[model samples]
Target: MQIELLVFIVMLGAFLLGNFLLKLPVSISMIMGAVLGALVAGEGFPLRHLFEGTFVYIDTILIISTAMIFMKVIEKSGAMEALNVTIVKRFHKIPAVMLIMLMLMIMFPGMITGSSTAAVLSAGSIVAPVLLLMGIPAPQTGAILAIGSIMGMAAPPVNIPAMLIAGGVDMPYIGFEGPLLFLTIPGAIFTVLFIGMRYCKNLNYDEIIKNLNFNMNAKHGFKLYLPILTVLTLMVLTRVLPTAIPNLGMPLIFMLGSIVGMFTGEKLDFISTVKDAMNTTVPVLGKLMGVGMFIQIMTLTGVRGYIVISCLGLSTVLLYVAIATVMPAFGAVSSYGAASVLGVPFLLALLSGNQIIVAAALSFICSLGDLMPPTALAGNYAAQIVNERYFKVLRYCLIPFTACIIFGIICLIYSKNLSFLV
Candidate 1:
């Protein structure tokens, strides 16, 4: 075996052993993988290289951390809830419209958090009971929230997979919004309308609307919403004006947004919210740093290069098939993990004449990992909220999940010619 391949196998074994045998946390398991690779590769177990690897993805780590904090603050401040309630009131009379809105609302949390689990626990939980009462089958309803959250996580503004893929090539975050929006918007519509279609027919549209009449009283609803608006406006300004506004970047933008969020209705308890934010943020950041170490080992050992060259050896047809197959399957572990581990190699191997669409397509595929099993974060969380088994939820997710992969493949096949989309 190639030295890189040998090290990779050993590291993977270390990861599994640490997780299953020693019962270590994911971050610690990854560190153990790094240690194993170092031992086998004759790196002499240098702490410097390990620390170096951990900081390789520092920018993404910061973004993920700050964004999680911003999300926690928004959730705690009652802004997200207020926003959800506000959206419900507009279309409560029209059941299908309300469902559409509800799906979008669920997606928003994921879009903002770049986490399907957050969406499921936040908006998905909020809507589950409502949808259940509408007589939607538990499986289909779970599927709806799953698809929506997946697409939302893959959506433009803060897509972690996109950031990872783009970082591989040193691409700027600009211009992803357009291609990603194209991928996710169509996904949201197709899944909701199709998966939700059956559930809509039996729902008493008028009755659901009447019950959605509950309104939240914010001191100033618009002012309460200013933080979200600030974040969006700053994002757009950075993209459109570029040089006009100093680019504070995502972390700073998130921090600023969190600050503005404090003034929202029922002033959020800052200490508790920050404590809550850090509670969730630290673990994710730790896992990311661990992945960074794994990636660093790959870089040092030429494993990433080996993988890229291996992909390059394959025919175009085989390459796409393999890429599509492995991405979602690996998602059973973690989407970000799949994206960073495979996406970089794919980026090197599959240069389809157009960089933007390929990146977007890859990110879209990786995002759907939430629909697959084992970890099936989005589906399991949605299933829990709906009181259904995850596999049952996955059963309903099959068509839409598979459909997204096919759609992404088609997009890749035509990526070069789809510049009109951007």
Candidate 2:
């Protein structure tokens, strides 16, 4: 076998051994893989390359760090809770609408942080009891949360996997909002409607209201929502009036929003909240760093080029099948890992299509890795919130999971037709 292929196998094997056998953090496993791959390729320690790889995603890391802090701010300041309560109060009369809205609420954090764990832990916790109060079973509630969180992780503004894939190919992380929204919004709506709509048809508004803590909305009213609005408005203005309004990058936007959150709703210890947010964000950041190292080594050893060249030989149908299966299956390790290792190659193989649309679709599929077994970050946490086994949540997610794969493949196949989105 070629040295590049051997190095690739060594890296992948090492990652699996470390992650499944040794039970290392996915980030560390990836780092182990990178180290092993470098040794196999006779690259010595390659410390300089490894360190360079860590900085490959520095911009994305900044976005995630600031966005997590922003998420923590809204969550701690009661802005998130207030919004949940307000959604329930306004839409309780319409179960379908309410379920969709709640799913969106569950998606909000992941949308910002590009980490499904954040959404599952923060918004999923807030929405779980409400779904239970609506008579949705624990398993189905967990499924809804899991699916919504993954979809959120794939959404616009901060989709790390998409960003990684784009970065891998040296593509700009721009013009993705349209394709991402197209994929995730409908996917999120379908998950909630399919999993929770039947149970939520007759929601108990009085009971839900009694259980919901809406003190922020009650005390602060419209002002409680200002931070969220500021972030949204700034994101839009930067896009809409790029020439007039300086395009504050996502990191700055999130930081500005976080600062606004400090004073908008509840009083919070800025230092403590920032520390907590950073603490929660470190693992994900590590994963990004590891993926960077892994991919950097892959590139240095010619493994990345080998994979792309190998993918170029596949039939379109086989390529689709690979994406539908291999990407998510590998995601069982780490979605970021799957994106950097597989997603980048797949994107290159499909370069005949609209690059932006194809990258967006590929990222959507990679995001589903968060639902894969053993290390189902979103699924595990979502199940915990609903007091259900992760497998039970996976069982409920089978249909939506399959649907997302089919939808993503369709997006890939028709990417050229969808170029208008870019």
Candidate 3:
């Protein structure tokens, strides 16, 4: 094997050894990989590069921190409880409406940030209790949140995976919204509907309604969600109405929302909530830091280039199986990493057809990495929020995961008919 590819093998081995044998935290395992890569690069510990690599995703780190604070504030302020009670009562009889609304609510954060962890930890944390109360098993709850969050990340306006693939091939991010939406929406609807039908009959509406914990005496019942509304409105104004409002990025917007939220009903401990948010973000931040180092090394050593060239020689039949397997399985590391490493090569290999279908199909496959094992960030985090084993969550995730891959493959095989996708 080439030196780059050999180093990559050592990196994976070190990572696994650290995680399973040494019993380190997940971030430390990733850091172990980076350390191995750096040593293999013969740089003798490049301190500056290691430090710089940690901050490569500072924006995403900030978003995760602030969004968790927003969620915690709502929890402390009683807004979350109030909103859930109202939603439960409103959708009590209609299981479909309950399922769809809950999924959409869980998905809202991902829609804005294009980050699955954000969706799961923030909105997923809020809805998880309700799902549990409705008798959805913990694994199923985690799976539902994870599936919904991935759908949101794959959808229009802020799809990071699609953006990565599109940017890789010099395709405009615009005009892709339609095709990507088609890739995600149907799967999302099916996931929620199936879960709801399976579990909704167990919901004890009367007990849930009777136990409303928050004092709902505020004249503006809907306005209690102003903090959340503010964040959403700011995100919309920044992206959709750029001329009218300065684009205060996600972290700042979430901070402002948290501050505004204290005025809603109950007083909140700003410092405590922020600290809690920070605590919640610790693992994610460290993972990013470690992963960043590995990615930096990958870019520097040209392992990504080697993989691209190697994969191009596969037949079309093998190509489909490879794409379906690698993108999601390797996603156990990071979907964005998988996208950057393999997306362009796959896109190039499959270029005998329409760009839109190929791009969406590639994104769809990459998006599945959100649920893939090891570092399946979305499902793992959802498991954390819902207090369940991450692997158990993966068990419930199999059906939706299978469905998404099937849809993606069909899109690829029939790309000719999908010219309308453009």
Candidate 4:
């Protein structure tokens, strides 16, 4: 028990120091925590253990890296820019139609990219000016971007973290695609629309018209759509298609897409593209390495087991609250942090076949941290683009976020296949 308490304190101290004192990214902080925990726990900071643990996260790094490269190639090719232009021109005359379409456009990329920042940076630039000109307040515009971008993160193909957690639970990766689309997609759409509609209610038609006139010309043409198509096709082939064809995974799909994207256009500069892709890939790998180390350290110190056991003793409602509150702290540090620290052990404990209610409840609640404040990176990026305060956007998100958590818990309770802990 003393060892467990010491480990817990060391882990928490590392988290605080990294997040507040050092101002390091949450993933780095997690790595720090793991290293510190290993040292303090008398494991003597084994280099081999750290290296092996870092190797475990390579899969995650590869997925994010390739996806980032693919996105960068798409962006540079001017395909994304053209798509934005097309969207704005088509919807310029109809505010309500434009809003819905824009929401979908942002959401689609997020689903594919799995990076809320990518979603906003890709879609928000185009949409921001339109909203600004239309008389939408900066805060409201930010709220729209934040909410729409979040919807994308919760969607399919690109939600790698969700896939990882689901995979950890012994659930097939593809199996979760269906549940996410059916349950989480609606939840995301409703959440975005709810916030958007409330803000849109007071706007005048003239104000909306004014926003429509702000430059709809594409810097480039629809030729760029090819890369986007390549990504989508690869996603379908790897995620939706059967393994009967042979080896297919997200990394291979991205590599193929990058190759195709390079040759498809007039320039055909494969060498530079690959180099650029590598540059983007490295930092992402570093981040995942840190996260993986954190998970390894937690396992070493036994805090994960303690937390799971402690959670098991709580009632369902209390369990939900505990998870919801604690997850944000980890999540704020890094999504991967939440995944490693809470997700792995939580899943392990729940999978004991004795705590399905709590397992499902925790899984559902964990996703909400992506939108929670202080470290709500998704919301922060959206706010930056639209010029809204972070807290304001978070306030609008409160209800929908809460609802999803509640619905997820109820789903777990009612799921016939899930066993309850009591």
Candidate 5:
């Protein structure tokens, strides 16, 4: 028991230190801590083998890293830039229509890329300029981009969090598609409408549209768009098509996209693109590796089991609140971590018929981490593109964030008797 506690403390401390002080990615910190914990618990303290086992979550990590590489290659090829500029130009005639169309455009890259950062960086570079040229405040532009990116995460294919959880739960790879389409899509649409309508209500739509810059070099040949379009089509097909078609998984498709992107243009250089993609891929993969290690260490140390037992002791209502609140905190730090720690147990609890309400409640609350301050990765990316403070951007996001949480809670309450739907 003492050794287990020590392992937990050391691992947790290392994770925090790496994240906050050393400025290292959380995954690296987690790996270091896990290694240390395993040594300490297995030898010195002699607790039930801290590394009771290892699961090759590294495969998932590789898949994600390759996806990032694919996105980086596409971004470097200027395909994303072209897509953004094209969308803006095509919709310049109507500001409201432009906003809606831009929302969809952003969603496309975001869903395929799996990195909200990439999505915002690519989309915002174009959208922010248009928003600014139209006399929109930086804060407002930041808000729009941040909120739109959040909505995009709820879309198909590249939703990493949803994918992780669904995979962990052994549901169909795309099982959440139906629920997300039914729930998050409508929720996102309304959220966009409400926010966009509120922001643009006072603006002169004609004037905004007239002043927009419709011409730019952010154009690409049809070939560059093909890979992205193909990927998007596959994603949609995965949702609707039969499972036996040997559907290309998202990671491989992305890798193929990168290859296609490299040859699509006169300026495109395959070697440089591959190298550039690797530069981005390495760090991302390292971090993911570290996260997997951390999760493994936690499992070995029995801390995760302790957490589960503790939660199980609580009444269903209290458990719901506790999990709803705590999961968001972990998610705020790392969505992957949240999925591993909170998501796994939440799923287990639900399967066991204990804290089922809380388990369901977490599906929504966990998303808040993506929008919260400090580590609000998605929001920060948006802010970076528009040159605004991450927290300031987060402030504007609170409205939609709150709405998602409230809706999730309502779902939890109602889902108690609707297990079939869940």
Candidate 6:
């Protein structure tokens, strides 16, 4: 009968009702949840808290918006296509290596945008025909894209889930690159090899090449990739040189890359590309805003404190079990929601471990929610790209998905030992 627990239930019920019954966008559902939770707690709308919550992820919104614009530039400019073709051409003889490289390529946009849907739609679309040509089953190909895209969403430089958890705990979004790269790079390699390597062993260079969009590579060659290189170089320079180069934040960095991209490949209609990018990005930006409001309300109503305290009472064993199971299951709503709702409290519960590493691992686990049903954004899109039912893809993902959860738990348990990553 605790008011905090009641408020939490009301919010969750409202979210599910809005999301499932009303078929509202996840962001809008979250807003409904927030509004209802406030009402239940007798906070009476609290416009100030709701508006304040929206700004919680303002920086993340900027980064994702600009990053999507950058992704659109690369896609439109032929940079993405050229890179995909180049990778296959270079590594096709070694099917396993080629598959791994292609998987990493699929992860690229998600890594930048912190969205598995971005990865699945952008790189996954391009890679699907190649995988099919390599003789991988459609279901497995979908699984590969789903898993890789999720890993990319969990990767460093723009991990939204990690940012949410860190923000929840008042931790700065620094020192995460090492832990995130540690988890995602190896995780991506494993998922690709596990799902696609055996099927890809019998190489089909001729067919894959036939399907490859080679026009971009032939037209612009290396220049087609300059924008990607420019952004990566800037990222590295800002990190490696620190004082030498100004730290252009992710938004500025992405914008700089987009600007450089305009001249390096096929010409782009600047206004259309920007408009298209914004159109695609607005929903996700709205989701983050909703998450901010949802969490802000949770904090205001003592629901956040209730969850944290409840978690603190559990044994470590139960904590890990809940994290591995419930966290991903929550992704049916939205992975970002799972992070803000559960990941923060879990991180607090596991404070005995290294925070950055634990946060990274938690984010990885939360990213699996993108593969969960209904709103399985990555899985659904990946399935569509490969012409497979998402359930079939989910069946194929069983082993790799379990492995990822296990690896994430291992990261959580031995976080201090893995401090070398930081």
**Per-prediction count of colliding residue pairs?**
1, 0, 0, 0, 0, 0
Comparing candidate 3 with candidate 5, which one achieves the higher lDDT? 3
What are the clashing pairs of model 2?
none
Runs of candidate 4 exceeding 4 Å displacement: 91-97, 198-222, 238-244, 263-284, 348-364, 417-422
Q: Higher TM-score: candidate 4 or 5?
A: 4
- Candidate 6 yields a Cα-based lDDT of 0.91
C-alpha local distance difference test of each model: 0.80, 0.92, 0.78, 0.64, 0.63, 0.91
Flag the better candidate by TM-score, 2 or 3: 2
- Report how far off residue 380 is in candidate 6 (Å): 0.6
In candidate 1, the residue pairs with backbone N, CA or C atoms under 3 Å apart (3 or more residues apart, or in different chains) clash, namely 92-209
Candidate 1, residues 314-412, lDDT tens digits: the string is: 888898998789988878656877888898778777675578788888999999987777657788888888878988888878888888899999988
Give the least accurate 10-residue stretch of model 4, judged by summed lDDT. 213-222
Q: List the residue pairs that clash in candidate 6.
A: none
lDDT of 3 by residue, 218-288 (tens): 54477688987898788667867888888787678878988888888677778988788678667756776
Could you arrange the candidates by lDDT from highest to lowest?
2, 6, 1, 3, 4, 5
Cα deviation of 418, candidate 6, in Å:
0.3
**Looking at candidate 2, what is the lDDT of residue 342?**
89
Pairing residues by index, what is the TM-score of model 5? 0.82
At residue 156, give the lDDT of candidate 6: 79
Query: How close is every model to the real structure, measured as TM-score?
Result: 0.94, 0.98, 0.83, 0.83, 0.82, 0.98
- Which residues of candidate 5, in runs, are more than 4 Å off? 1-6, 43-55, 76-78, 89-94, 167-172, 201-224, 236-244, 263-266, 352-364, 415-422
- Model 4 TM-score relative to the real fold: 0.83
Cα shift from native, residue 340, model 4 (Å): 2.1
Higher-ranked by lDDT: 2 or 3: 2
* Residue-level lDDT tens digits of model 6 in 1-422: 99999999999999999989999988999999999999999999899999999999999999999999999999999877888888889998888788888988999999999999889988899888888888988999999999999999999789999998998889999999999999998889998888887787678688778777888888887887888889999999999999999889999999999999999988889899999999988889988999999999999999999999998898989999999999999999888989999999899998889999999999999999988898899999999999889999999898989998999999999999999998
